[model samples]
Target: MMVRTVLLAGCVSFFWTGPVQAGMPSVSLDLTDIAQLRLQSISFFLMVLLLSALILKLCWNLLAKDFPKLPRISYKGALGVSVLWGLMFLFVLTMISGARELLTPGAWEKSGRTYRLVEDKQPDDASLAAETTLDERRRKLGELRSALFMHVATHQGKFPGKADETTFAKEFWLQPGPLQARYGYVAGDKQADPSEPLAFEQAIYGDDQQLILFTDGAIKVLPTTKAQDVLNGK
Candidate 1:
């Protein structure tokens, strides 16, 4: 009987319990572990209690005097106790699991934001020093627009009048933003043969230039926002 109880506890624990380490390594264990442990402990205790009661009943039936009646062991009582134990286990498990998620370090952990900043260090302090890089980029984009307009005016409103790299380079120096250029250009409609993978509208980001100038002449000061957005777009 003891062996059966032990085996039951072991099997149930094994099936119900998850590995000690399950979540993201950096985030470690949270509420789930607590729930698993609680359920296992309750199961173990219930098995032991029932096993003891069964053994006592067997002994009493065999050895007790006829005149001195053995105490009543109602199946109803055992069933009620088992049900109560199960419900209590479930209640505690549910409450704790829910509570742990609210209390534990998850999305609320500000460290995630800190890690993001550390991960995306700018190419230089120059990127950080600018008061408003986006604003500056917006202004530059206007200049590029004017240049594109002029190129079109000179060549009957058509891009790549001759489709020469030097001519296109001179007319519109595709200043792919740091974020956009790093990945490479998206070809514009004007260029019959773009740098490579001719795109209808191109954006260039060259590491050597130390600038992330967009084809639209917008600057990307923070590589994270602009760079990530552009890269993720692809």
Candidate 2:
């Protein structure tokens, strides 16, 4: 009976209980520290309780011969105790699984398991805002270029004489915005070869950092002098 009990326990332990891991090397974990996470919610806790109870009852029946002197335990009471044990285990598992997160005063403990940042770093709003604005400007310019390309495709091979400010996202057309002001439009019925032609460019960035869009569907950043030379038939 004892041999069978030992064999049964060994099999269950080998198959069921698995290893649990925590965080990176930077985050330390210990057994006794309070877990900062909720391992099981209400529904999951109920499920685990019922499953633990079933296993406990099965084990009790199987090991009855080994412990013939043991007092009889009602299945209901044994199941209730098993559920309580599961709740305690759920709480401990959280402690073993430490988090690599920002530490706050309310949750921070002076124990070896708890870690905190020495300094607080804030974002650079000025640079972030500048980057966001630049991205928006770039998108607007691309949209305008696309609309002009579509116009030329169906308008007998001629680029739009003027950018329509009121043109917007009605369906296939992209909207034009104030960014169009940077572009110096050329007035002509049609240019036989617009392959190397300069449609418009942005001079807002810098004299040497101008974003120029070409007629050949190529966009490049060039110096103001070179771009002006291209415009002047250089």
Candidate 3:
């Protein structure tokens, strides 16, 4: 009866999570984030496991005999314990699985959108620092576009002149920028055609697919050599 009750409660939890997850997609967790998540999951698991075991033992001692000693022995109480623990077990298992997916590359793709945008490929010299820098740079570059557009709107359709990350940061009220801009900047006023000139670069890192933000707010990823040509007015 205990096993049957536990299985029924487990099914209910699976149903609950499935619909909730369907309505709200999973967001990938970072390594640091998942570390905390796993700790919580383990604590939850242990609490439920111990509670269920204790309840089952108590129920056996009180009610599992031809002539039970305890008059207060109730099947309902054992059923409640089984159900509660089963639900808890399902929840903890789901959390652990989600955390594992977030920490594992290629695994996050299945889970949903990653918290940190991951590079398509790891560079030959890629390390934790490189990946962290690259992710920060990518996010900053996207954010910088908004500030640049605001500048253009206010300044006769011209972007800020020769600006760096700090300049855009100031423009956007971010105070000090999250990180220095990897790319150089050219004013939007200089170019008539939106696609003609390089607005900014990833010159510092010198990576292929250097992020090139355009005067028209369109961004392109280009190789370093081709990006140099564009910057040189080739």
Candidate 4:
């Protein structure tokens, strides 16, 4: 009975905790595409650390029972530990460098945008900085969109009748999703053009449904059927 109770408690805790990420769609940052690259870099480094630790732990478990108290650990064991440590240190250093670069004006902003306005310009530190500014603007736009969505829900008792970059930037900067112009919502016939990737939805992020736009120009629909497994992406 005690074992069963503990199991039930564990299950409950696992199923009900943390941020309410339920019914949230996975939004891919498409604008700059560089943000995706940055994410990939971070993800790969984390994977290396996690995989190394898991392999080392398993090896230690398997070898511990067979080996007696030894004066020295194997070279392979030391190498494995060193590799993990080195990867972690490298990741930290990379993050510090990236943060420094982003702190510069227009560097972080250039990260997210649908198109590069400076395609003709030669690639340089300044050009890259400009791209970062665009990226930051895009993110701010997304935040503002989300906030406007909630406001529309609260005051109007529904989503906005129409959404544009201008109206959002003008109002609710102090409230949710406040930023410079970035997010865009098209309504009616404007969204009817199938040649374009656009949709007029009552809400971008909803209780039962969440809409996510990827830089790849794909829209993903995420359902919150099981709240515990929400937003993880199938």
lDDT of each: 0.48, 0.59, 0.62, 0.49
lDDT of 2 by residue, 30-50 (tens): 534234233335568768777
Give per-model TM-scores. 0.24, 0.34, 0.36, 0.22
**Which one wins by TM-score: 3 or 4?**
3
**Model 4 accuracy (lDDT, Cα):** 0.49
In candidate 3, how many Å is residue 132 off?
3.6
CA deviation > 4 Å runs, candidate 4: 1-31, 68-84, 87-234
Clashing pairs in 3: 183-201
The residue-by-residue lDDT of candidate 3 on 76-182, one tens digit each, is 66667677868899899889877876788453443243344445774453333244455555566667777767666776765555665234445432211334334
Root-mean-square deviation of each candidate, in angstroms?
23.0, 22.2, 25.2, 31.8
lDDT score for candidate 1 against the true structure:
0.48
Candidate rank order under lDDT: 3, 2, 4, 1
Prediction 3 global C-alpha lDDT: 0.62
Between candidates 1 and 4, name the one with more favorable TM-score. Answer: 1
| Runs off by more than 4 Å, candidate 3 | 1-129, 133-136, 164-182, 204-207
Worst 10 residues of 2 by lDDT: 171-180
lDDT (10s digit) by residue, model 1, range 28-108: 446587798888889998787788566655555556556356665455565566667678998998797667667753533
Lowest lDDT block of 10, candidate 1: 192-201
Better candidate by lDDT, 1 or 2: 2
lDDT tens digits by residue: candidate 4, 1-234? 999999999999899967765686787655567777888889998787667766766677678768776334454665578686797998998898677666653344343542222344466543343343334434544565566545545654343445443244554332122222223344323221233323212222324543433322344444545321332332
